[model samples]
Target: MAKTVGDFILERVQGWGVNRLFGYPGDGIGGLVAALGRNDDLEFVQARHEESAAFMACAHAKFTGEVGVCAATSGPGAIHLLNGLYDAKLDHQPVVAIVGQQSRSALGGNYQQEVDLQTLFKDVAGDYVETCMAPSQARHLIDRAFRIAKSRRTVTCVIFPNDVQEAKAVEEAPHAHGTVHTSQAYSEATVLPQEVDLERAADVLNAGKKVGILIGAGALGAADEVTKVADLLGAGVAKALLGKAALPDDLPFVTGSIGLLGTEPSDWMMQHCDTLLMVGSRFPYSEFLPETGQARGVQIDLDPTMLSIRYPMEVALAGDSARTLKALIPRLKRKEDRSWRGEIEQRIARWWREEEERAMKDAKPVNPERVFWELSSRLPENAIITADSGSSANWFARALKIRPGMKASLSGTLATMCPGLPYAAAAKFAYPDRVPIAFVGDGAMQMLGVTDLITVSKYWRDWLDPRFVVCVLSNGDLNQVTWELRAMANSPKVPKTQDVPPMSFAHYAELLGLKGITVETPEQVGPAWDAALRADRPCLIDAHVDPDTPSLPPHISFSQAGSYAEALVKGDPDESGILTQTFKRVFS
Candidate 1:
């Protein structure tokens, strides 16, 4: 007799440290769910939707540095997962998606819940596979899932055939066989370019001009190296938002974020610097790139593939950030460039001061960014923050300053809507003692299933005073896309979709038995967030926002703008509606 595929899945998942599953189960996945129920080590999440399940798993994996798992049945359930998978891939967030297949006997017979599960996600998932015999292929699929989840840091889906899931195992119990490999990359010392390359680089730095370092995601673990190299070369730090946590935001050598949506200081610094050191960052927006009249960028990355992919570069060097920075640190002298660091420091201080002032502002509608910053200040050290895309994520990234030792997870792409609630749930699942705050736009919260907060509340409440601060900015539109469209294309007035109406997130939250607050005024944001965090269970602060005040778009190239502007000016639109839209924006 052959053991069932579901049993083998549980056995293998146990090896990968997967104790719980996240998802909404349908009839197609029943056998697997039953198998999960039988296994003590593996539990099920029971999310409100399949998309949220994948998102929760993605967030869990990002913070825990392990494979986070989610599951769903066939057809529409499986379809819901693609959007989240796209985001996980771009951000390199680790996740495993286990979906059900139509019974094996139903293959090519026009089955009810049928989908070519493996092929459907081939383009998006780093690894796509299906389970067969539990003793052999099932265990092997588990290994593949873990590998893709770890190496590619993206979603890996295993479609379990219903009949195969019910088959008996040849062995008394199934065996799981995924293993973790911890190999270190070794670099052999190479001869330096005889002081000439260093001389040129040093000359660029020592010139009587401003110098800056632009940071990105690749510098996460190499903050010290980046800092040391900057200190030795007298370069100021201005990081991409994705690299926000790379170093202490309050560091004296720091300016701020540089790009279109960036602070004024970051814009000034990027424009003023004569030499720019690109360390482990591959920021996509070209608008933030220093103009040709200003600074020239020198990119340093682990892979040469990232160089010149998005923006033009003066030089591209392939090397580990820390190792390269270590080599460069000693060769450079540490003399101040007079007003260079001082000017940046003053600008940063001014921004910080304005941020402080914003914290004190009183208005009819609370600013979401101001609320996030306030909530961040009150949270305990090392508190987890999971943010969805849109205004909420932008505000969280902008306002929730990353302290050196603290951990965070935010969607680095724009594929999914409501990842916040599920992400917070996963963070709590992994570290129950450390409360995780999930920030999301109102449009996203509804899309994600906020009521599922009760599911987590059921098991983890005893972790004591459950502090999952789900701050929902309720302006009722997908503001991130709207803002981008306004800038990228001359779309007149913000377009309104008749697909959905203004939603009440606060009402829905309380219906789920979680504590809730409505922040109609800015004065109430801090107090509301503080109260929610102090509550002993799940809570939400429906922070009403001014929909009119949109998050500005990040910078990009003038050529791209010229193309769109020409389309607008030449009265060339694909449709009358497009022309009408363009007219609205032009007038606005």
Candidate 2:
């Protein structure tokens, strides 16, 4: 029996355990969509836009660690997927992108919706990108996409021409017993650094009087090993934003986050430590790291290129995080110093107090920090929170506490907006039993989040647990960009481009057959979340946050202060208003 190229492609992807797919149907991929409809095992989710579909795919991979798949039509539709594909590429998530192309007859003729996908997607799909020129190559191309995506943990693309989708000259079943290879790449295998490397890493760490730990997304499964190592070394742990949930925030010495969104304890601990143990993190901010010669370091990462890239290392261990840590543990020595750990605990306590004080500030509009703090207290222990890139990122990094069993992610590397809603929707889709929440800023919620809200509405019944929440931090501004402009560029205030019209996200949700509530006062923040969690359907909470409130960094620089002063003298309209709000916050 022979199969259409589309049939063979679908069979190959489904064989890889991809039951869910996100895509937008169009003339370019109509044959592929028809092939998809012929199968009952695969659920082809129709998204409002190709961009959201790509984001949903990336989020699916992030939450489940599976090869997320998405498809889009040629030209504009395929172009729309670039941003979301970059999200997966930068975060090192496995994703397979199936792109539609113009018919072979129309190739390079300036036909409608025709694009040279191979060239356009080269950067994102660095590992693999192939156009199925013949029906016989369909299975091989699809196999290569998923294989490369999973093994390399990056984006892979398969371009299917419109004519090829209908071509019938391929194997009927690519997953048949005789055709498949039983290789270890298709299964899990334990990986660890060499014994000598592990021993050297342990020795470097053990020799230091004061040690600190920095963890990232690569440390997700090695939480216990990381904690044990930190305990033995009496070291404080500072998590990269991508590793926020690697360890429970309640851990005595775990500093919440590092960089501009870092806690005071994290900044101090990393700088003061005599030695550092960096596991699975490529923390980009060198400023937050210890001065080059200030501390000796041991770096552990699966990618040899990533090891010791950020900081100079005394020892580099390249392998699986959990396996390497387990091997190194026996070689490690217990430190006698409780003073460093004690000081970290004290700083942690003080940071919490300061955060609480800020959270309780009585500004005319509700404080953004309060929203995260309230959500932190109210969120379920197993909730999966997805935050958008903006001021909300800072608030979540500093204020939200990730409890054990809970998972959270953001567009950490891409740092793009509009992924919050799509990410939450995908989280709910992947783990229906767990609560999924999206914490987004007003500007981001307006950008593409609102457009993707219908995705939640569309998939509400698919989940066994019907609870999904979108917490809109409605401050009517790109709060994060505004601060960056003021602090870094010496700008007066948020530019007109950064400001957005006020939106009632709650009303929008209500109109779409979901629960929606608008909370203006700080007092209403807690109840809004409570109501959202208890609601039977998807929900949105539009919390009116203070636009004048500044997302001040943990450490303020002299240059930033000077910029602020210069901006005020240049007559920013909001300067007096922000000053008054700050005064009220400090006093009240």
Q: Which candidate has the top score in TM-score? A: 2
Error of 2 at 110 (Å): 1.8
State the RMSD for candidate 2: 2.6
RMSD (CA, Å), each prediction? 6.1, 2.6
Among residues 3 or more apart in sequence or in different chains, the pairs in candidate 2 whose N, CA or C atoms overlap within 3 Å are none
Candidate 1 residue-wise lDDT, 542-567, digit = tens: 78875545444333457546644554
- Taking all chains together, each candidate's TM-score versus the true structure is 0.83, 0.96
Query: On residues 1-588, what C-alpha lDDT tens digit does candidate 2 reach at each position?
Result: 356777767878888999999999987887788888787889888888999999999999988889999999889999999999999999999999999999999998999888889999999998999998877677767877888888788999999998999888567336655453332237655667888877788778888988989999999989999999988999899999999989999888888899999989999998798898899898998888999999998998888888888999989888889988988889989989788889998999888888888888876678888989988888896999999999888888999989999889999898998898899888888888989989988888778888898877887887899999998988877888777877888887756777789778889999899899998888898988898899999889998888788777667789988887787888776787688876765456
What lDDT score belongs to each candidate, Candidate 1 first?
0.68, 0.87
Candidate 1 accuracy as lDDT? 0.68
* Superposed model 2: Cα runs more than 4 Å off: 172-185, 581-588
Worst 10 residues of 1 by lDDT: 179-188
